[model samples]
Target: MTAGEALAAAAARLRAAGVDSPARDARILLAHAASVDAARITLIAPEDLSPDIEERFVNLVSLRAVRVPVSHLIGEREFYGRRFKVSRDVLDPRPETETLIETALAAPFGSVLDLGTGSGCILVTLLAERPQAVGTGVDISEAACLQASANAVLHGVEARADLRKSDWFDGVEGRFDLIVSNPPYLSADEMQNVQPELQQHEPRIALTDEADGLSVYRIIARDAARFLSPGGRVMVEIGWTQAQDVCAIFDAAGWQTIRVLQDLGGKDRVIQAQMAEIGN
Candidate 1:
């Protein structure tokens, strides 16, 4: 079949199975199967796909129809203009997290520490963008640490990014002028209601605290000061409804300069706070 015909068929199947952005997903999977850039797919739309490419595209579409994330199938996800390798072992980097990236880049920091760095998108992006900055990324899951490490290497930031397995700050050391996280902020109740792509394809540990979802924030608020350099700032991506509670957690912990920043969607997506400077 021609590339366009295959995409149309795949899209129809995905739509029937309730996949969001079916057409987009079909186009991307086809590009991956054909070993070409997604942007080039349009140029090939009228061409006949090779036998192997067509077969692979069919298999990818089948899996996607079953709710597997396109990133998991294609093996990479774009974040902050760079693509990072991903799998079921890591949380797919969502566009919302870019808000944290923008806020982090807004400030100048020589060192950064990323907690729960599932895919290393945040840490790697920062180091790649700043060139002179260095960062450490930690995750509780060994698999996630490996994935993050691979991503760091993929982005040519391996020399500047320290990827390791640590539950939050357990094995982390030193102080960072910037601390950032996109921690699991979904509550147990919310988890049950998330999209099938999250519930089935993504790692569960990266999606929730297995409780109220604010536990990680509480921990960060209470312990981050010990790991942050004097005058350092902490920025975190949050669920839209979580700004009030997250801000309160940081406020009560004496975090000054607390500010909530919204995403492109106008939803509260990131909260920035500063530890007490040299003097309060």
Candidate 2:
């Protein structure tokens, strides 16, 4: 009936459904239903649910109980301190991917390429952070490209960001000073271990390549050099245990100066490398 009461009830329902972080999720959903901030949910006194708000809250909680990602329910996720629209069509942006953005920003580049760009969070964030830089985001899913394009517009970087529907480098052209990707790296066996929210709700093409996790990395390793400027850099997010194998892929491709960067959790999160100079 009231905001607090509705939140409490939704949290109980979610908890009973085995949802993790039920209370927190309930608060956020309640705020979305009320069209207010989550922090403001606590300030609303009892008897304020209003029939319409109550109904919306109930529906959202039910969906969340099914393990649908909150980002999809709310239609947005925060990445690199900015909100990017998300959907089942795109991979929900993860905090660990920020490592790739940080690594990209550490150096100066006038152009960037983001393969399997998904929601365009990585490419958009980079272009937003570097006003002079322009970037292209490529995704196999046309819906994902549209979502990423909307996010680019939301971040006021649409003019500098190009969204293309392409499988890896197929439709992409020209060379970039920096190329980055968080491609589908999970193996079929590893896919079985992914959380229900990801395994069931998120797009499978964005999660695993259906074989060894290294398949996408191999493709990137094989094709990235042709799309990269001489001495240009390539950065990719990798599975925690994939540093050695991914590094080997890049090495075999003749990439020079390969290095692994860790996330805040100190996991091997990103592999950065520079293309060998022309004639070298």
Candidate 3:
């Protein structure tokens, strides 16, 4: 089949399987299978697919039809203009989390920490941006640490990145000028309502707190002070409706000047909290 015919057939299959954005997913997977940039997919649409490309595209579409994330199938996801290697072992790097990167880059910092650093997207990106800065990324899962480590190597940030398997701040040492996270924020009920790409395919540990979904925010708010340098800041990604609750958690913990920043879509997507310098 020609590229156009193959894309139509794949999109129809994905649509029947309830995949959202069927045409887009089909086109992206086709580009991956054909070993070309997705931007060039349209340019090549009228061309005939090579036999090997056609076979690979068919397999990839089948997996996507079952709701496997395109990033998982393609082995990487772009965040903040950089592609980070991704896998089923770690949460796929998402566009929404890029808001946290933008917030973190608003200031200069000598050191950084990323808690629950699945895939190390935040920490790696920060260190890559601020080349002189060093960063430590901690995740509870060793597999996630491995995945992040690979991305650090892929992006040449491994020299400045320290990857560890730690639960939140446990066993982490040293103070940092910045700390960031995109922790699990979905409640059990909310998890049930998530798309299959999240509920069935993404790691459960990266999706929900399994309780109220605000558990990790409380931990960060309460303990981050101990690890933050004077004037240090903490930023986190939260659910759209979580601004009030997350701000309360930080406020109750004595954090200073809690601010909510919205994503490009104009929803509350990041919580930026500052730590008071010694004595005020």
Candidate 4:
């Protein structure tokens, strides 16, 4: 069948299965199944699709109808204007985490440490954008570490990025000019009601700390001073409601210059703090 005919059929199937934006999703899925860009779909309308490609598109539409996330199906996601491979093993990169990168770049830092760097989006983007900066990304999951390393290579920052396997700071052994993390901070109750797409598809370990949602922050706040050069800063992505509690953690850790930056949605989503003085 022609590409346009396939899109129409896919759209009807999606609508029948209760998927929203059926037409749009159909177009994207069809293009992807054909191994072509979505824009190419419009230009190549009324063209023949191989039997195998048509069958693959039909299968994808069925999956989308069941609410499987498109990123999972596509095996990659675009973040910060670059595409990063993704999987069920990592949390899909969120836009709010870019605030961590922005705040880090603005700070007085030449090197960075990204703890719990799942897909290496923040670390890779930073190294790609800042020619002089080098960074290390640590993750507890070996799979995540490998994925982050792959992203580093994909973005031409492999030489500047060190991907390590560790839980938090357990295996890390040095100081950093800046430390950042978007660690799991979702509380148990919150996870129970998270978006179906997230809860059903994204890795649970990447979404929650499996304890009080703030465990990762507490660990980072308590130990970051040891890894941070004097006056070196740390930026962490937190849950929208976590600003106060996270600030308290930093305060108790003796960090000063604590600041919370909001995302485009005006939600306080990133916390920045500096290590304390020796005498303090």
Question: lDDT tens string, model 2, 172-257?
Answer: 99999999999999999999888889988999999999999899999988888888887789999999999999999989988779
Work out candidate 1's RMSD over C-alphas.
1.5
Q: Superposing all C-alpha atoms, what RMSD in Å does each candidate have to the true structure?
A: 1.5, 1.5, 1.4, 2.2
Model 1 per-residue lDDT tens digits across residues 124-178? 9999999999999999999999999998889899999998889899999999999
TM for every model, in the order presented, reads 0.97, 0.96, 0.97, 0.91
Better of 2 and 4 by lDDT: 2
Report the lDDT tens digits of candidate 3 across residue range 1-280: 8999999999999999999999999999999999999999999989999999999999999999989999999998989899998988888888888899989999999999999998999999999999999999999999999999999999999999999999999969989999899999999999888998988878999999999999999999988888888898999999999999999999998887899999999999999999666321
Show the lowest summed lDDT stretch of 10 residues, model 1.
271-280
Clashing pairs in 4: none
Candidate 3 residues lying further than 4 Å off, grouped into runs, are 278-280
lDDT of 4: 0.88
Candidate 4 lDDT over residue span 215-245, tens digit each: 9888988888888887788889999999999
Kindly give the stretch of ten consecutive residues in candidate 2 with the minimal lDDT sum: 271-280
lDDT of 2 at 182: 97
Candidate 3 TM-score, true structure as reference: 0.97
By TM-score, the better pick of 1 and 4 is 1
